[model samples]
Target: MASGDEPSGELASSLRAIGARYQELSQFPTVTHAALGAGHATSAGGQTFPLYTECSQPDLARRRRLRFSRHYSVHRSPGSAVSVSRAALSAEIHHQLLGQLSPTGQHRAVLTRCPGLGHELLEVWGSTGRSCSVDLTALGKHGEVYKEGPFACLTWSHAEKQLLYVAEKSQPRPQPLFSWDAPGAARPAEEEEEEKGEQFLYHEDWGEALSTCSMPVLCVLDIEESSVTVLEGVPEDVSPGQALWSPDDSGVVFVGWWHAPFRLGLSACSNRRSGIFYLDLSNGRCELLSAEHRAACSPRLSPDGRRLLYLEGAVGGPHRQCLQLRMITWHTRLTATVLDVVQEPTDAFAGIYTDALPPQCWAADSRRALLSTPQRSRTDLLLVDTEAATVMNLTAGLPEGCWVLLTTQWDLLVATCSAPHQPPSLVVGVLPPAGQELTLHWVRAEDAPPVPGVSWKTLTVQVPCGEQSPPPCGTRAFEAVLLSPPAGAALHPLVVCPHGGPHSVFDARWRPTTAALCQLGFAVLMVNYRGSLGFGQAGIDSLLSRVGEQDVTDTQLAAERALESEPLDRRRVALLGGSHGAFIALHLLARHPEHYQACAVRSPVTNLATLLGTSDIPDWRYAALGLPYSFERVPRAEDLAAMLLRSPIAQAPRVRAPVLLCVGARDRRVCPTQALEFYRVLRARGVPVRLLWYPEGNHALSGVETEADVFGNCARWIIRHLGQPCRAAPGQHSP
Candidate 1:
């Protein structure tokens, strides 16, 4: 190993190799968005239609990502149960951002962000070869267009004359501390006063990735009139978004998130208190359409426009939980009826676990909707009958992997499917008639180049049952996906990976890190321990209050079981994780020092007590410890002690493995100080440790260049430590 902070020659070589491998993987573009065209035709071979998909891939040369739409003639094969030929690319549209097709399909609305110029451009392109552009920043000083969260939306009116979207509410222009207006430039004293105090006033945003989204409001654009209007009647406390024009265009339906108690981290959190509401344009009245107290979003209207479908989960609980499908009947202009489509799961189905539904999810029948949700270790596309309250797994016949529903138009459905060892490939399927088993014959719309030398399988690890053992109420059995090179080779080094979210599940989908490591002859074990989602709410609730003990034990047991079962070198095992996963990884390293040769973590939760006051999701710290959170609740001595006791910092003294800490300096979810504290402890103890700080990276460290650097360095770190034998210190013992 190198004597100082700089990487060794071997480490540099491995980093370059890993970077090149990742760049190779980036060549396969994944389908990001799909839009079906107006015409639908049936061919004798099977079926054919015009499909438009927005594909994205990392442009390594430019150090950025490139997104473009491809038009294709998708043809399905009749001989196969459900399969499509790799459709030839018919046409390509480049430099389009957030394109929304009009109802009549004769026009398209495009919203593009020009960060370099510090503004946004909205363009409307008509089929007749005419297009108009509007500089949103200049139009009315409406804030940047929302690109994420429940507030992110771009929809067209049925008449195609208007467009509805969400944007941040304009803020008062800042004024000098002491300035006098010219004699001719007289301004109202009240308006001038409003700008004075706003210069440095504190304003809370939606949290993390949504830093600029402090106050979101619905906005409508009149194409012909060249005007933009911020819809009224929305309560000041409510942040309205996901707005869509109502059936007759008399009103707009939207989801409103209340900013009362406070805004917790909204990224990947689905249980924020919100509801579906309708804003009447004529009366300027906003009426709550769904249960006001329940958490709801993704208000999708049916094909016939008489029904409204949305998802609801319990409020003030887990950050993410199983959602209950619901449909509301628009009986009259004044009244509506609510129906519980899938309130709970049946024997075969687990529950609905999805952040959002596709924009074009409804089928031609107006009752069935296509949704992809986590089911165990894989994501399955399900055909949901809103009226019948029945669910069918549409992708059950596919290989054990993830099948994500992208969009649907008429009877046509588009999705991207992939396995742990495969890259994402676009597939198209036509919905079958109602009351029939949905054996969707999926046709490959776009093919991803096959990844060589990688193979994977799912392994089930049953939680040990005993009186002294932790309660097995939620997770009786968990699973892990192990990816490795082809068989008949030397036993490979193993990397035990635990996922963050403790509530989030690790799907058996293609990941660049896993692929790169597997290709480099390292077997990667991705453990979806007890607390992971897709197993059920019981499994998630089971780990509460038992974070360190239960999660640590579960991961250790899963790793040990894999070591015993698979052809992996027991002595050459390392740990890799992020956030909560990193917390578990550190615990495993500290408690079972002899088992792991090294450890690499990203923005780990080292000391929960210290993080409670710093993290954006302080509520998560409380919820993980089987406690509820409130802004008014003060942390007592015992609470802080309990938090530290369950955190990895308490066990840091026992950790002997060489460690690599990757942290984003700007991370708000888990502060960078958490990694620093751990690094200091390990360095003080004379443990070989290195910390890589990304100045501009956030909690996820998900930037294209940042991720490449992280993964490449992580590979180098693991390789260096795994090449040598790891021995525990004189006093340490495996748990």
Candidate 2:
């Protein structure tokens, strides 16, 4: 087949023969439709897991009836049995299928199915917790409820029985505003130029009275009355975090962080702080309860409505560096007292401070409470005896994990544990009599794809640095699943796949794209470099300013180690990544062009200055890059230049490898302008580069057509640049 060409019948037959040979030699398992069901039902000594899906005639019929897998399945019982209601069918399917799959009875159901909103549906978990659908499409456009799904929070008024929803509606071309409403409300007229001007005039005159100055307002919908009202207004400069309704639905609490302003002719603001505000729904009055707290976050109300439990500060920093479980008494006018503080001096940063604080739920008596301890490197489940002021650790051995506690009459907890290279599994257990120790019971283990013809091992090596102790580097080593071809595949190509999230570690999850690469004949090496989370704060801190230097060294070292056991074509190695991974790819091409034949980068950060200025997230640029918030308070130009030198765009001309840059036009996280500017510079410098822009995508390429284009183009690019024929020809598809 020619480059980018689809095979004809004759070519297909030839390719099939080649595929068959590899299939035989590699022992690639034939994955049939029947085999697609649950594999290897192993019990951890528990009741037979509730089966979520059954091999039934209805399932078969539904499968055959639908042309696509996205369609919903309809089941009919034999012998003309009474027809089940749609709700009953959904409940039965989830109960029988998911209940069997997961012993904890924890499953999510997507009820609303809107295609334009990309199957926008409510995701209902358990029987209570209701979260709105936050899918990009749903959050971006305003329209009818497109999909049917479970809701995180659904409340029907005891009086009105009307349903209120926290929803998004598209305004103009670029803005999405969160609004409060009930079903079947009349739509507001689109704001026109004349109307906008008049509104602005009115806003300038009575903005404060009407709460129009607020960027986003907290709203409450009285379902029975079909009335919507703004409960509170978010301050202009502060970024809102989470909002929660009071148990009685008479009040709302929201958390937000405000950036400290830079003083003229002085250093930039050094402190980052947040506050919790309580809004009275009856009167639209807002008051700050903990206005003095710095960096306090994740406030949860106690069961009795007498106290609040929250995390104070960033948890482990120069600031309040302790994870203190605080209690606030409403009787004391919302005064807070620190109850128990979790901190370790040996920890580079107090570990508990960085952990996320989940919701606090009460035990049956409402005296004992269960709350997730802030996750250290590993998560620890904690049972707090409120009256006794004592804390007990549960699930101590599980490292780098998360847990959910269901405080039903019987206290049941489900925990998921995982490490750098271990696939995660769900474990269920019950709290002991005294709520001290946990009685462990295995529930279900995640089924990881068996690695064919490969054995995997892990190794830690010391990377030497001049006059200093070499940084400890860890990697998981695995043999290639596909064997070399008869020509012995002597010059087998290698791929250096760096994961996104400079701080996110790589784990042993089943990634379809990664497996596809292996099936297409490539040896892939994924690296979890320094600054990755779950390894402790020191590891994460190491990558703060030294992003490219050490990470690149580790990547190169990993490649060298991989080459020791296999014959690799040094000249044919390529670097591929997305998001922050894309940043590393660009950095590699710029700093070590000769090391890679080509590079593919998606949604990469090109210019640090532009990134800081235009990123959707406020204060992230300053915090992540260790930069001052405002330019006026920044250091001298020389110092700024030194910092900017580390940016990818600055070193673009030094990139000798062919480049493929992909970006999403609607990506708010990493603006498309970054890619556009980088491509512009590369072309100006006469570098061989291809730029692909997806107008409909955001940070992720999700649509089927977009994903096909990305993968197909990437494969074709690799083959063309490496002097190999492509399976899909140019005219066959558009990249």
Candidate 3:
């Protein structure tokens, strides 16, 4: 029977029965598109044509082509026949002309004139594998002068029909490329004389003026004349990372507190409130914009250039709320109004609520916006109409996971959907004229490997809470997806996978881990506990202070319901999670140790106290746990205490499962020390625990190479401690 059609209890039984079948099917060899063939147009000489092919050709050809009309036309004289002899024209036509005229001919042509500025290299590739490069320097006065990577911030200036490039200095010194402008230029005699007089007046002045420190510098470049001017000494309080120019390009808006008149420390005012300042280019004058207690970011200019739009708050601090978008008018005064506000819903999903993820972007007209609302297991994208105060869910049925939406002309929407089992892909849709039906275009089916002999089925389970009736509380049924391995004679191991985000929801998608586990003969059950985002605010609000309790019960119930339908070895089950999911894993071991034999946690928040105190973004903890930054002023310590009661550190002594903890050393979100401290407590209690630390990683380990390592390590550890010898070695396959 298909698991999707079965009740939650029956679904689990079906999965156990097929475990062996899944394992057997997983051993077969898999095939993927490896290469494409070269062009096939015949040359004039009748020789087998060879146009251009980078790699080896595939055994079979599968071509998808698109063509459009060219806009070139010719005019002929009136009353005169313009027909020319085809033979004569063909003989005279050279290969170059033929290549240029041939619609199917492959030839590379220069696309952009600029070259060697703005990172010195810009490569663009089309879907058809055609690539073009542009050197910004070659564009003369039009080229960009400077570029910064990792974030791709760039700066350039034009003067006298010439473009000048300003690039950040590389490594050790790490200074902004102000030298790109006025390179090798000397100061005027009057300035030199004034500097000398100042030097004589004060020794400190001489040292300060002569010293050159590496910092973010703004340069003015003239591409036509090939000149550079280095504007070195910026205000001391200006943070380079937050420095940007005004919309009219007349001044720079610098955020931070200045220490000396010119030496700015990036980390100095990071924790404190920052002010905005405007620097005039004409007279080299600096003026304070506002003394507001907020860090400003993402400054955008209104279409009419009358106002400025920017997000204000410390980059990662407790005081950080998605500060309202304020429109600063240029009347030399700042009056602010909140463009977006959080709406409190009466029917919040199960009474669950969190400030919805701030709207990502505003529509071109500034009237509509996109917001992400994440429940415990899923996330939903909402289209907010500011005019009507109405919100429409754009991605209604997408499974629980992170998604991003991009708007095009006429409000056409494109989004990328992702989940544990599903690779991210672009989904395009057109909103109807009346905004009724959304026509989705399936450009391409996702290319994902099947789960060998196993198949996934969704089941509806009545999640029971002690306070509720036996049939379960609130919503009568919660949907859960179960993956059963191939047919097996004996009971197989079970793995309960709880998604990250106590407020996130789960969705259906292809997952490599799910495939691997099924191949290894384990039945996997994924649960969408309360507080997950998809079902709306109420669903997410339900799991607020109930994380360890409600979420754990949901996961346990899903697993037990699965077992009821299938014969399984209950003692062989395990739990696995990463991030918030990791918190769930630890919670399982602490509160229900007897249910699972082992657990794996990746970048888990072990101690709620440390999470609140040490996390780079203090606002996240404050919002999630409803805690105040200052202990002396905390109003709801009792509620905060109740939430912290589920901290894994507090329950370390009671956990009996062998544990594996993974952390990224440089993780700013969830401090690496949290995992270290938890490991310390667990190890001291004589509970089996192991820790893996990546020195140069962040909160997410999604880069391909790193992900491979993470998955491989997880698989190896699970197999090793679970007393399971590999039925087949890694990379071994059947014909």
Candidate 4:
């Protein structure tokens, strides 16, 4: 039977038994979206402020999508123990709900239900009891609506009469050669030929999870007129996204990316040639607001609309980098100029390590904004004062956890904080005064129950240094999160998980899979190898052109360190990775075959040579190799040789460990061919291997059923290969 398909033999019963462990952990609530009102209300009982928040958790038992959304009203009082009042706003099954609170505190919510399916509903509701429902499926004129990525947006106009969002530009309808019209119908020859030819034309997409998104255009929906118009002023070469209505509501300001170099994947990538542009609806003219060469995005206007804030980074090289905060003084609509650099990264601060700022990030003073950014292993909230050109870390005094700023309303700041040992908890606090940190009196808006019998600690791996050998990747050390099982066995099986995006960091936060694995009696190790984010830019820059060698070494050293210090069974160690992490896992399995007993890779990159030509971001391979990349650059013999030399396939013959490959057929990032190449090699060589193909899944394998199924099979593979029982009794060791 195919992977993810039901099996008929005894293996089917084993998977079902192993998958039951994820039920409770998968249902852990997560704060999805929250909105704060403009002002508070005073009642006879006490002063109460209303805050709207949405909580979602995966319904893994269901055969449909994994998560369901629940809306709540959180009420708080000043100078007293804050209590949250749970009032269910609605019980609708909405895939996404974007809530916008008007300046007058009138709530406006736009719900998109059954997204990505042929039938979709766009429902809008106002606090005054007025609502509108638009059948996006029946319209059939526009493409799928964007709900994620850099282009995703849903914002209300200043006057609250219209809604603005981003969606794929409509394509020309192609009809069959023999139409079902009247048998004797006469049609123009030119029109018939055009329709027939267009049916076969190929169009490129944004790739990976956003495969359906291409040709993003600004769309405006006028509620009063019940009309939707696609704005046409944007240049065809520029893909506009993250649109916002101008201060006066006369035009739309958005980020425009040039299509010349080919639209590289924009998922976790930040360094793309893009600029902030303003499109005037009256004259159908779009003007670039930021410099043409700067990679800029996330434009936020102040409350008074006097200044704009954004983040900018270098144009090329590593897809993700430390961003510099910038500001623009909007003296008037006629003219706006680059004001000054708000904050440049220093050795102490590590720059702005986030893609975008939260909505309503501005403080009550309007001179500062609250930003959540990663620093090493923890995510911290930063207070950026534009006037003083200073950045302060606000979470320095808070409890140990990853603190993320969700949204801000006036002087109130809302965030979700969590640690490896703790579940995510939504907390709201009043912004503390300058120079003073926030007191620990934050009111808990909502909290998720922690998983039982799971414990964790952060580990620092010191890179081995010899007199003759310098530190690999220009760093002497990195960190890892080790989740230990309950203290039953002296040594438990270990599963080393390295995250994707060599640039991405695995923060010390509660993750569903990590927690579930621990509950299943495996000590999980998440390594933040060199070049991972949160570390200084120097760390990120050190990994350039050294993809295979240094990254592989760093992961091995980290795992070795965890094994040495923790109660982990070095003999029963297994490997788990995705994307770039998978590349490293494969390299480790081949180079140091004895260190790992089994391996599981999801959407792995086995050969860079094959992926460079088929991936959405071909520049990734070149950049990883420290070579120049452009749309016009053709792969030469030497370049191909270098890619092959660094690939895991070059050393696949040395791999003796049983491997499990989880591939997404729709993945455009690493390409399914890369995984298939390794599978074919292992199979031909008589090596033990298995492949699970998710036909409808993307690079993330994010489908509700796909994720649960993949995790269950992965756990089963590791357990069986490591000589452990399929279902170990709680607080007991499996012989």
**Among these predicted structures, which one has the highest TM-score?**
1
lDDT of 4 at 1: 21
lDDT of 1 by residue, 13-115 (tens): 6666666667776566778888765754456656555676777777767788776667776554464234444355534444455788887667889887766
The C-alpha lDDT values of all candidates are: 0.80, 0.47, 0.48, 0.77
| Span of 10 residues, lowest total lDDT, candidate 4 | 726-735
Report RMSD (Å) for each prediction in the order shown. 5.4, 11.6, 14.2, 4.1
Model 4, range 351-444, lDDT digits (tens) per residue? 6778998877898677888888887777888887788787777776465569888888756777899887577888877776666545535777
**TM-score, every prediction:** 0.92, 0.61, 0.55, 0.91
How well is each residue in 1-735 modelled by candidate 3, as lDDT tens digits?
000122244434434433333333323222111111122223432212211211111111122111111111111123211111111111111111001111122322212222333234333333375344444344332323223211113332111121222333222212332334487786444333323323223111101111122333444433334344544445654433335456556666554343233221122112234555676777787776654555554444433345554444333332213233444666565746434322222232211122322212454455555545443234556654444545665565555355544322223343456554344443434333335534433231122233334556665677544444232234434656677665555676777887775555555654556656765666778877655544533444455445566677777778888888765568688887887788878877888878878787788987775665565444445545544343234435674475468677778888888888777776656788888888888787778788888776566654444554565556555554554522321222221
Full candidate order by lDDT, most accurate first: 1, 4, 3, 2
- For residues 641-674, write the lDDT of model 2, one tens digit per residue: 6446767888888988877888888776678888
As for TM-score, the candidate ahead, 3 or 4, is: 4
Clashing pairs in 4: none
Model 4 segments more than 4 A misplaced? 1-17, 38-40, 43-47, 66-83, 89-92, 95-99, 111-123, 131-141, 175-185, 188-196, 332-348, 467-474, 725-735
- RMSD (Cα, Å) of model 1: 5.4
Worst ten in a row by lDDT for model 2: 29-38
